[model samples]
Target: MKTIHLIVHGHIQGVGFRYFAQTTAQSKKVTGWVKNQEDGTVEAVAQGTENQLQSFVHTLRSGNRYARVEEIKVSEADQDQTYAGFKIIR
Candidate 1:
């Protein structure tokens, strides 16, 4: 199991990116949370198998029909997050 942290940049806010990410994560069986950052970025943490994590990140980058993702910053995250399911944080 691994945790992937992502800071998605570009016009991601107010575009249902968080909800899109949550749905995508759930479909991929990735557990974690996604939220809007103050810096106009979307921050997400996903934990799962390598394949699942990869797919989750892909979905985030591709975004939904409303989003226009410019770039995505990826990094490792602490494995102790232990989220029960994917969610959108306030």
Candidate 2:
């Protein structure tokens, strides 16, 4: 399994990005959480198989129609962090 933490910048907040991420993650069978940051960025942590994570990353890059993602900072994450499913954190 693989896990990734991503900080997405640009027109990401208030653009249904969290829901988009949740749906995309579920489709890829990944478990994660998406949350909005005070700095006007979107943060997420996804865990799944390497293939699943790769596909999820692609979806993140593409984003939803309302989101104009300018940058996504990705880093290795602990696979031990678990979630029942993808969720939008407040």
Candidate 3:
């Protein structure tokens, strides 16, 4: 399994981006948490197979109709962290 940290930029906040990400992650069988950052960015950490993670990233870039995703910064996450399911961190 692979874990990745993401900082999603653009018109994401207050647009249900966290819900979108949680749905996508659940569909892909990825376990993680997504939350809105203080800097008007969306932050997330997802764990899954490489293919699953890649697909997740792709979907995030596309975003939901209400959200216009400009960029997503991805990087390897701490391997020790694990989650039972996908969630939106309020």
Give the top-scoring candidate (lDDT): 3
Lowest lDDT sum, 10 consecutive residues, model 1, at: 54-63
Candidate 1, 1-90: lDDT as tens digits: 999889999998998889999999889999999999999999988899999988888777788999999999999988875889998999
Error of 2 at 73 (Å): 0.8
The C-alpha local distance difference test score for the whole of candidate 2 amounts to 0.90
Q: What does candidate 2's lDDT look like per residue over 7-88, in tens digits?
A: 9998988889999999999999999899999999999999998899889988889989999988899999877767778888
- How much is the lDDT of residue 39 in candidate 1? 93
RMSD to the true structure for each prediction, in A, is 0.8, 1.0, 0.5
Ranking by lDDT: 3, 2, 1
Query: TM-scores of the models, in the given order?
Result: 0.95, 0.94, 0.98
Q: Which stretches of candidate 3 lie over 4 Å from their true place?
A: none
Residue pairs with colliding backbones in model 2 are none
Question: Tens digit of lDDT per residue, candidate 3, span 1-90?
Answer: 999999999999999999999999999999999999999999999999999999999999999999999999999998897899998999
Model 1 CA lDDT for position 23? 90
lDDT of 1 at 56: 81
